[model samples]
Target: MKRILTIVLLTISITVSAQTLRKYSNEFMNIGVDAAALGMANAVTAYSNDVNSGYWNPAGLVNLEDNQLALMHSSYFANIANYDYLAFAMPLDNRSAVGISLIRFAVDDILNTTQLIDAEGNINYDRISLFSTADYGVTFSYARKLPIPGFNYGINAKVIRRVIGKFASSWGFGLDAAIQFETRNEWKIGLMARDITTTFNAWAIDKDEFATVQNAVENQNQELPESTELTIPKLQFGVAKKFIYRHDFSILTELDLNIRFEQNNDIISTSIASINPAFGFEVGYIDMIYLRGGVGNFQNELQIDNSEKIGFQPSIGVGFKYSGIQVDYAFTDIGDQSVALYSNVFSLKLDFSIFR
Candidate 1:
């Protein structure tokens, strides 16, 4: 045990000390949009049920229940905007598939500010409690399953929309593809490419004319073109093995690797980019109960500041299912000292589906 721990710690130090930034942002789930990496190996992304497989692995859609729809919602603990996801898929003659999905970020409540210059260089303070909401991204997908035994493949496209409270919206789109392989009944492997054309156009930047002290820049722009034109999402490849302990009980362990297009400078952690490796295990006890836990960024350097990036992050979650529905929850934390306290994250997901 001591050897294992030592090796693990050594690996982490090396990873942190090593260089380069991977893409799709390192720990954005806690800081900003830059750290949101694609999730992996959740029960929601597990075997069997199917339906919303495209989000995790487009190829998984090949084996899902025909004609299905799943919608999930979660409220973050920090009183931030709620997170929402909706998925609908229909199998076409057992060979082809079509799907549509939407993910939106909505925040509630705001302290509206009023800027005024009174006579005699005197100013009065008046604040109005208000709320402004914004959302981005809509996806449309079409996939086909390969006839080869134990092999499945698919493709997808996403149209991104940037919407500000009531201002003009910006538009962009993305493309994705995936392949999955299975052997008899023992092992499963998957390779997925998300956001090939990760171009986020930032359009409505704030004009210097607005002297208001509020978040005018953010409120005025829905889609601002990135400084570098295009920043693509990192690529993820994973493998898993499943073991059955009983006729109705089973466990699965998976590992995922992320490689992005970020470059890291040895100093100050340019992108906090490092080869992120994650290990997760899932135990399904009976057909209705599921338990899961995982540590992200194990052996990877942990950085939470704006200058540095952290690719690997550890997370743990549990889920349960009854009939045609299921719910999943995950908790995550990263960073150090002052940043660590604010880095904790809680996520809730609900899946509802039916076969037509």
Candidate 2:
């Protein structure tokens, strides 16, 4: 039964194998924060007051009344775990703010494989090794209230790095800019641009650094291409609508779209067309309690479960307030698995605000 389970898992994995590398690749950096993840990509225009705002919509920082620091960590289902984001925003005398943040994502223990032959004239499993995928990026942002009031704009500078299994690494930079407009009617609108630099390039592999006595791996001994960086195109946008029935009740819904121009079969970039849509909503009473859910679907190209044949990317989350600190959690189901292959997601977030 265990063997069968493994087989079933492998089969399903193989089918989705194409997305392994780019599946978790995201434009929204604060993936672990439940409220954001549960609503697909709606957090882009959604108001974020946590330290994670550095990754979601830095423009939201303009609303801070005090300087605050934050940290967040997450463990993805499937033995994949990552640490991300630490930031502090300082509110100025006016409705302007400045903040700095750092985020990192890492995958551990990947088995390296090679097709090889042995002296016995038969196939043999030559070796297995562990490799890691990790990336770290630093961000700096500034937001200010418009002289006309009730309007704001912000921009961020990001320095990022992508490393692959010690064989290579790529480092570059990009920018994120945003605009926020608010009305007396309690309506808000926002827009953001990501990776304006169009970052690209991968590290050059050092063939000369190959481990000793191994002919099984490809290009055991061959001159390599000049070190080069892989190109990745980027452009993502998000919109949001908020409804406030009273001081203690509200409903928030948002939609996001991103487009990927280059086509590749790797795990480094997002699997979608760089042009995918994610929608989600949150309903709450008095800002004291909340409920949230959303979907991130890509039709036939990416389904949560092959059995259902529908890309049912559904998510749910909740939030609570205690004094001035708030806590949140989210659960998600990535549609595309058999009963045994569960892709459920859960995460927690904490927020501290000075305003009563």
Candidate 3:
């Protein structure tokens, strides 16, 4: 046991000393778009049962029995930014399903102060402009339950686009795959591979489009023309269980771990880290009303320094389901000591079985 503990400690130390967070393009892809999932700190990979599952775990789309549509919107940091998502799913048969989804994250109407002055150093407030930065994605998802009663597989093909104030833009593509298993006794397991083919973004900047403004503003940095960025593949595993105490009362609990492989400058060789572990629970009453809570990013010991707390986000939410409609609301704190940040998310879902 002592030897094992020593090895474990050494691995963690090596990991911490070797890796630094690398910047990636289209970071909005990492944001959780589903209110229910985010409310549970994204531990729903194994408990996916709704249309939003198209984004969380495509295999979960097999759980849908009706044509479903879901919409969600979130306001972050007191309305500093907005994130929205929409998804629709339909069952093609008893064992197959397909889904389509869209994501938009944006910060609009920001003042462009870089060109506020003329070349002769005269104040030109009229030269100031307003612009928006936005990221978008369209996803096509397909899921199927194998001949085996409890096994399912799914895939997602996604197209990504990002615009930065009309000065720069990017286009990218990626794929994700997932598998899930369930038993008669309410135990579930899931695995997901995100960006399985290595999502790549090819950026094209029209620097000449801003040439007039650049000439008007002195000492402004020149924009680059083209570049490419690759998003490394990520793997996640989850397990969940449901406990039923009464016909109408039950609780669901889940745990998830995320792993990412990236270039590590601090260590001689590439290091592996199971960095983000999340825990969540849901209490349901009659399947009509629900309460949810979760905590994530508690990687205190995994950090290289005392001041850098990589994890520590907590969230809570509530939901109501009646007839064929479901409504949910969630609150999450994503703050640090210097910046107090919080987000509120709301979602609505409708299910209708026209073919049934």
Judged by lDDT relative to the true structure, which candidate is superior, 1 or 3? 3
230, model 2: CA deviation in Å?
5.1
Runs off by more than 4 Å, candidate 3: 1-23, 210-223, 263-270, 301-311, 334-340, 353-356
Q: For model 2, how many clashes?
A: 19
TM-score, one value per model:
0.70, 0.71, 0.85
Error of 3 at 239 (Å): 0.4
Residue 224's C-alpha lDDT in candidate 3?
42
Model 3 TM-score, 2 decimals = 0.85
- Please give the distance, in angstroms, between residue 2's alpha carbon in candidate 3 and its true position after superposition: 59
> Using TM-score as the measure, what is the rank order of every candidate, best first?
3, 2, 1
C-alpha lDDT score of every prediction, in listed order: 0.51, 0.57, 0.77
Error of 1 at 107 (Å): 2.9
Across residues 1-356, which tens digit of lDDT does each residue of candidate 1 receive?
44334334323322231222223321212122101112222322224225556566667776754566666555554656666667777777677777776777666563333222333545445533353444555666666667788777777776665443332344555678778888887578777777666744433423221223222222332222212223376566777888888679987788766555565432222364444555677778886776676544433234556444433345555666676656655554433212232232233333334432
Report the candidate with higher TM-score, 1 versus 2: 2
Over 1-356, each residue of candidate 3 has an lDDT whose tens digit, in order, gives 44334334333322222232323655687788767777888898888976887888999998888899999998776797899999999899989899999999988886665555556767687876777778899999999999988999999999999776666677889999999999888699999899999888777766674554444334434554466777788887999999987789989999998767753321122456435678999899998999999987554333455454344778898999888888888888645421337788999988985324
